[model samples]
Target: MSTAPTLIFTEALVLLGGAVVAAPIFRKLGLGTVLGYLAAGAVIGPLAHIITGAEEILPVAELGVVFLLFVIGLELKPSTLWRMRADIFGLGSAQVLLGGGLLTIAAVMFQLLDWKAAVVAGFGLSLSSTAFALQILNDRNDMNSAYGQRTFSVLLFQDLAIVPLLAMISILGNQAGSQSASLWMDIGIAIAATLAMILTGRYVLTPLFQIIARTGAREVMIAAALFVVLGSAMLMQAVGLSMAMGAFLAGVMLAESSYRHELEADIEPFRGILQALFFIAVGLSVQFNVIFDNLLLLALAVPLIMLVKGLSIYGLCRLAGSSHNDALRIAAVLPQGGEFGFVLFTTAVSAGLFSNATASLLISIVTLTMALTPVVASLANHLLKGEAREEIEEDFEGAGSDVLMIGFSRFGQIAAQILLASGRDVTIIDDSADRIRQASMFGFRIYFGDGTRLDMLRAAGIEKAKIVAVCTQKRDVTDKIVDLIAAEFPHCRLFVRSYDRVHSLSLRARNVEYELRETLESGLKFGRSAITALGVSEDTAAAIEDDIRRRDEERLQLQAVDGLRAGTHMLYNRPVQPEPLVKPKRGAEQPEDAL
Candidate 1:
């Protein structure tokens, strides 16, 4: 056997290669790059045996999870998390309890396991893949949808749940002795560590980052951020908690800090590569032969586990006041065992709570279920067809609007607010119940339904509406809405917000009258400020903007024509066509010689 160090290097190289090769193919297949990573890991670890030392690869893989959790933490502001309290606390709590409890019962019955073992199994199996679900939702442009928000809420709760779960696991390990004090001590240490980190982070990290940023040394900032993550992780581990928990807390601490955006940008590339490696490591760890041997048991357990979790999630979503269709959608998306479940399950086996055979069985089941999620989501889409239509119609009929905003997000909200203030009747439609409630609180009328669906558009007064604005986060959904508007509401002026340049071009192809890249306007604002700072007169700056605007309008008209012929209208950065400084009536301008 090769030395551990050599094995580690070999495995890392293999994983890197796999990710590079598989990602593009998966993208082309419309399956997403995540699936590509999984496929790569599966091929190298199990099928090809490129990296034989799976155990040595585990820790490196775990770094991916840590980075991913950290990024997730950075994105969540306290206010946003607080607003999702109902879904996170209420529905999330129910999902963990009910799903875990039922799974525990089944484990006891089928595997004839001890109560402690069964409980561990149950709790472990209850989680759905946050990484997988989030990535897919992001791909589909549904991350800001009502269903997406609820899904994220539940995932956030699950991430937090790891704390108590770890504590309980430690407690369960010492059940033979009166070790309650140790559990309490562990919990106390964890809380203290988290508080200390938060306080220190608030006072120190941001300033430190600002100093580093001013130097314009990218590597220094990267190193400082890494130190924070690794240091926090080490401290948590010293306190007998998981490194992941510490990473998550650190992220939350930085979420509202001034340097949050900078920190995120620096950490993102590392997070992506590490997370992909982590997924690959998971693939490598799977004992495919063992799964084949216990195929019957694995098959029985997988479906039953998915069914229980799905039903529990669906019930909780409904109880949390989600529409039936949305509840069903949540159920479909989250029925599988999550990445955390695999981690917990493997830990239990290593701790002697489960046999190697059983661990392999459970892993196999979880893997199969996770693999099935995209297919399940596709099925849910078909099942929930037409439901969005009825809801949209009812909402629009009630609003009696002449203009419809499909997504009541930041951009959409501003547009709706301005129009409403201008005495224009506007109907707002969004998928997030929380957003809708908040809008209602602010006296803005909003409806809940998928905006991409034609039924929802009609329900939102599509035919009567003179304008439609697609300003959601998802490009695909935006494109879909644009197409629908062009087909059905041909006269309705279409305005869309694209996530990036590519999305803007896609919208332009659909002959959208107004397409704005979300960041472009902000970039232009910055450019104007810079020009003014550089001693350009305010009038000159304004004229320059006007000139650029005129060119952009002309480009849009040209793009519309190009879009009709081909599916894309590519924009190039060329010098704007210089306009005549002054114009005279035809045949009225004097020749230079005459002058």
Candidate 2:
């Protein structure tokens, strides 16, 4: 009885128990689950010495990040991703070049490490922890915000930078001549693998899922999804690229597929568990002895790394046209050394660019920064000048319908009710996160998105809609949506809610199929009720209401043709003696007669 099996089982139990106990407690304290997982791993491995072999568990745990990137890819269609090319390449490249350059110079000036080691360390430290940043953004429901998107762009480019960074390490070492050809070969192979994954995902994956779907075995679907992710990941790793990048590419290829939601549903549980384990594994691998030896250097290095990266990110974002607030938020959210830095530093040690002690120092610095990220991000709020709006995921599952409602404000909500009562299917989309959450409480299945975005409209299924209803609260937002639909989807019928009489006139001028001033009917009903409560008969009140509505429509038509002042005579603005406030006596002429 070696007890090896028992030990393995015990370790698994400990990891699970730690996660179960730690995640919720840290979340309750608002410290975040990332920090909690780190704390749990620290306690279990380094502090308590109950678990060992973090090195062996780490590679498997890293698949969590792979699945995380894949899920993120599923939200972004290729066309949408293409729109971000400028930020991804321009802003991202600038951050890496500038931040890496500055850090390398500082390292050399301060005699931190050999020039070669410093080079690798500088670039590695320039990269921020994608898992940490993304987790925080997801926790705050900010992944779809402009700040989050830009931050993600930089992170994406950094992931891309890993291949070249590893190549640089090989070049810097004595193995340069021997590995130079291998480096180029790796790049070529990575490109080929990426192309193969894209082709396979585009041509083979959906059909395979469709076939598996016909079998109707959910277990098989889950297995197939796992196979796809792992197989793609293995292919990329074999070619010297990242497993996460490969999974992300596969996900992007299937982003517009009908089965995307099913795949996400199947993969989500595994991603969560493994991702938590990855964070914990990182915590387990913390080298306390090295930290104790270089405590003073690390204290200076950690804050210095954060400060340099933050300033570089903030300045680059402003130069790239981000607002001061957005740039600062991006900086606050992303100043940590990434998990990729661990990989880079370990590789550097093997490549003879640095020693194990040096690598441990860098690793400790990275870990400390990651641990401090949440606290720093929270503190950033005090520095913020204005409020940042919360953003939700743009998941448009089950969205196609005959009636496409663009906004979910009060008017749209009431209109949606009538449509639902009539047994019509409606797909509603709104940009407001709070409104979407509130709507869910009342049983409305609305998607979160900006209606003015053509891609969002398309995702909400504008092509399948028979009627495009624009009921946004703001006049400008309404006009932009209306104009967008009118330009891109002329065949669809438009039914618009106008903010005022001027909006009504504008909509009519644009040849909208139907447009109504949102307040007109309610205002008329209130007047009708008031007149009926007085001396007017019900029939007279109704007739007067109808008459007023007809006159208002006439005035709107006139304004549409001529100008605002064109309908002034019809507004009942003639200077006359004031009317009595008291109800008229019975048998006196009613308001209808006066009309």
Model 2, residue 178: distance off in Å is 2.5
Candidate 1 lDDT score at position 82:
77
- Candidate 2 per-residue lDDT, tens place, 334-381, comes to 999999998999999898888888888898999999989988898887
Q: Pick by TM-score: which candidate is best?
A: 1
Candidate RMSDs in Å, in order, are 8.0, 18.0
- Candidate 1 local lDDT, 222-316, one digit each (tens): 99999888887778777766676677778887898888888888888988888787767767777789778987877777778888988888888
lDDT of 1 at 175: 56
Residue 457 error, candidate 2, Å? 36
Worst 10 residues of 2 by lDDT: 575-584
Total backbone clashes of candidate 2, pairs 3 or more residues apart or in separate chains: 0
Q: What value of lDDT does candidate 2 attain over all alpha carbons?
A: 0.88
Off by over 4 Å in 1: 1-10, 111-114, 141-146, 163-175, 214-216, 385-564, 568-595
The CA root-mean-square deviation of candidate 2, after full C-alpha superposition on the true structure, stands at 18.0
Model 2: residues >4 Å from true position, as ranges?
387-408, 411-595
